[model samples]
Target: MASVDLATSYAALILADDGIEITADKILALTEAASVEVEPIWASLLAKALEGKDVKELLSNIGSGGGGAPAAAASAAGGAAAAAAEAPKEEEKKKEEEKEESDEDMGFGLFD
Candidate 1:
């Protein structure tokens, strides 16, 4: 079952590598020529997803966590990091409030 999926994927990649347009028919033909039986739907889905997209650029961006332009992604990541840093401060405030509630439950406040 997995082999069939992999075969279709490989066929699409091969077409992309060779600078050929990937399509459902081409994928199906490649898989058939390689003696690997793959479902038609898989090929169609892969082809649809890759249509009008740069395969090489997509491959190069595999290591990047973001999908847009590199500079935009970098700025977004920086903003995310800043937000993450501020998150701990909010969590600390929550913890302090919880501790105060627990202390009141014990019939004592810090000053008393």
Candidate 2:
């Protein structure tokens, strides 16, 4: 698809999720004026949606009628999933270390 179409599709998804309901023509015009690539714009919108919402919401917003290169969407999803998964692992490791420290302190009867 043309860059304009991709931009419009991305904008439509964003607007729908935000309840803005803007026209595709407006989106095309804005993207053309900004000269930014459609993939980046779509990625940004997806990121924003993910911030205050769940993955299901984000997927529903962008799953249908959203237009961008398929490869871009796939890569973006993969990257986001990897990052989200890693975040929990890191948090768990930190919690484990904290727990160990707490156990050591209790063993010393520091609180008593």
Candidate 3:
């Protein structure tokens, strides 16, 4: 299994390095030429995942955690899921804003 994964990954990298579009056919051809048996689905999934993505740039930026990898930080600060879940409820947001404005007008939050 590990050999199959390595063969497919190397094949994809080779295609990317040569500026050739990576496809399941190309990957399978490379693996077959190298005498490695790989599942077609693995190659297809890899191709789809890498579609429209710059492979070299992706490799270069592997250390940058700018995507959805900050789950722990988001959860620690506050529930990121909760904040996003609230965005769809406009009425709740409006009511909260109205309450805040009214409280401010009553001088309840001025000193605080």
Candidate 4:
């Protein structure tokens, strides 16, 4: 797909999820704010495509479809699944360390 098309679609998704009305104007505004350089036609097409659609339902259905390019890329990269599985353990350890540091109070005070 064209880069403009991709940008417009993602902008539409964000607007929908935020409960904002999806329009070419809104999509263009978002893309412009992000410095995406999208064509006007792409935003208009996405707006029409999303008309009368429930954003939350569409997002849920998209998640359910599963196994797209990201999974394929991870497999191609080798051992990505193992790394991903280890991520939560690393996060838990970091959180525990942070809790311990916060408990020390470091001689700081609310008014100091």
What lDDT does model 3 reach?
Answer: 0.87
Model 3 ranges off by over 4 Å = 66-112
Worst 10 residues of 1 by lDDT: 66-75
Candidate order (TM-score): 1, 3, 4, 2
Report the lDDT tens digits of candidate 2 across residue range 43-97: 4554454445444465768755644555455567897755665676799999989
Best by lDDT: 1
Ranking by lDDT: 1, 3, 4, 2
C-alpha local distance difference test of each model:
0.87, 0.59, 0.87, 0.82
lDDT tens digits, residues 21-92, model 1? 999999999999999988889899999999999888898878887534555654778977666657768999
Q: Candidate 3 on 37-75: residue-level lDDT in tens?
A: 888999899889888998999899998766554555557
Per-model TM-score, in order, reads 0.59, 0.28, 0.56, 0.51
Report the poorest 10 consecutive residues by lDDT, candidate 3: 65-74
lDDT tens digits by residue: candidate 4, 1-112:
5777778888888898899999999999998988899878878888888899997897678865754755666677779765875687799999988977786678664466
Q: What would the TM-score be for candidate 3 when compared with the true structure?
A: 0.56
Estimate the TM-score for candidate 1.
Answer: 0.59
